[model samples]
Target: MVSTGITPSGIFHIGHIREILTGDMLTRAALDAGMEVEMIFIIDTADPLRKVYDFLAPEFENYIGHPIGAIPAPDGAGKPSEGGNYGEHFLSPFVEA
Candidate 1:
């Protein structure tokens, strides 16, 4: 099954870690219980209507292709990502999965 979240809590949050941990925990449990599982995560940073037709600078304006981890982050809590460029952040997680 496909599960999706908009990540409204900004790019930097324990919420991100929790969502990932939850997905991993459940997937493992599903495996032990003999179930096939697939997981997908979308940053949802590019929704037009959510933009209210406006772009968030450094984010919508200049941060395209960056992963949620590497950007300036919604709160600057840290670098938050191991990615080097925007494209890596946007595509790497699923690539590894």
Candidate 2:
């Protein structure tokens, strides 16, 4: 199995989306296309630097540790914030797209 990780350091933002989901999506498509494929999603929570991500999004800093990347926005909104969820932040583009 091929393994990959989307490191959640600081403002991971676009890079995170590209790695975990987008990359996996490509792998899945390749597999369907008859290519040998194995995908492993790794949440690299061991890095000391990741501790700093909380600082970047201080509003959510208290949620540090437990599966942080998926931590629900404090208000159940759809976007993320230093202060929002992914959707609330990108609702504009999402609507257009």
Candidate 3:
């Protein structure tokens, strides 16, 4: 089995893509060589909000110690009940791409 994950902290930067791509190439090569391989992509939605990111609003300061997934969507794309799944906000776009 092969596993690779990103925290979805904010942007899906090139460095993040590099890691995933590396994992994907390895998995594909293994499969092509007749080796059974399982690839797992991780999204750490529950990671805690640390310092405020430059792109974030001042309101996010209140959520420093909370789990990002438990906070409201910064862009108003979250549900009232779920507030927002922080990782989901960034992960969704990456997956779709």
Candidate 4:
């Protein structure tokens, strides 16, 4: 089995692309060689928020050490919003792409 994991602490970036692509390429190569391969992508939504980033509102300080998936997403003003959880808010666009 080939496995890759990502922590949903912030925006997905180029480093994330590299990790996922590396796992995918490895899986493809193994499959092409007639090896049975299963690829798993793990999203670490349960990880805690470490701090309030520069882009985040000061109110996010209250969420420090709390699981990202349990906190609300940031609004346009960088304050917590009721739309969705923090982890999913950042991960959805990456998945869609």
Best by lDDT: 4
Candidate 2 residue-wise lDDT, 1-97, digit = tens: 5567754444446666677776688788988899998888775544332342423445554555544434443333322445443223323342355
TM-score top scorer: 4
Q: What is the lDDT of residue 34 in candidate 2?
A: 92
Question: Candidate 4: where are CA atoms >4 Å away?
Answer: none
Cα lDDT computed for each candidate against the true fold: 0.47, 0.50, 0.77, 0.94
For model 1, residues 1-97, the per-residue Cα lDDT tens digits are 5465544323345666677777777777887888888777666544322231122343444444443344543223223333353324434454475
| Residue pairs in candidate 1 whose N, alpha carbon or C atoms collide under 3 angstroms | 65-86, 65-87, 66-86, 67-89
Question: Of models 1 and 4, which has the larger lDDT?
Answer: 4
**Distance from true location, Cα of 60 in model 4, Å:** 0.7
Off by over 4 Å in 1: 6-11, 48-97
lDDT of 1 at 56: 35
Query: Model 3, 1-97: lDDT tens per residue?
Result: 8899877878789989888998999999999999999999877777898867877777678878788778766674322234456667767788898
The full ranking of all candidates by TM-score, starting with the best, is: 4, 3, 1, 2
Q: List the residue pairs that clash in candidate 3.
A: none
What lDDT is reached at residue 86 by model 3?
66
Q: Which order, best to worst by lDDT?
A: 4, 3, 2, 1
Model 4, residue 12: distance off in Å is 1.5
Backbone clash count, each prediction separately: 4, 10, 0, 0
Q: Is candidate 2 or candidate 3 better by TM-score?
A: 3
User: lDDT (0-100) at residue 14 of candidate 2?
Assistant: 68
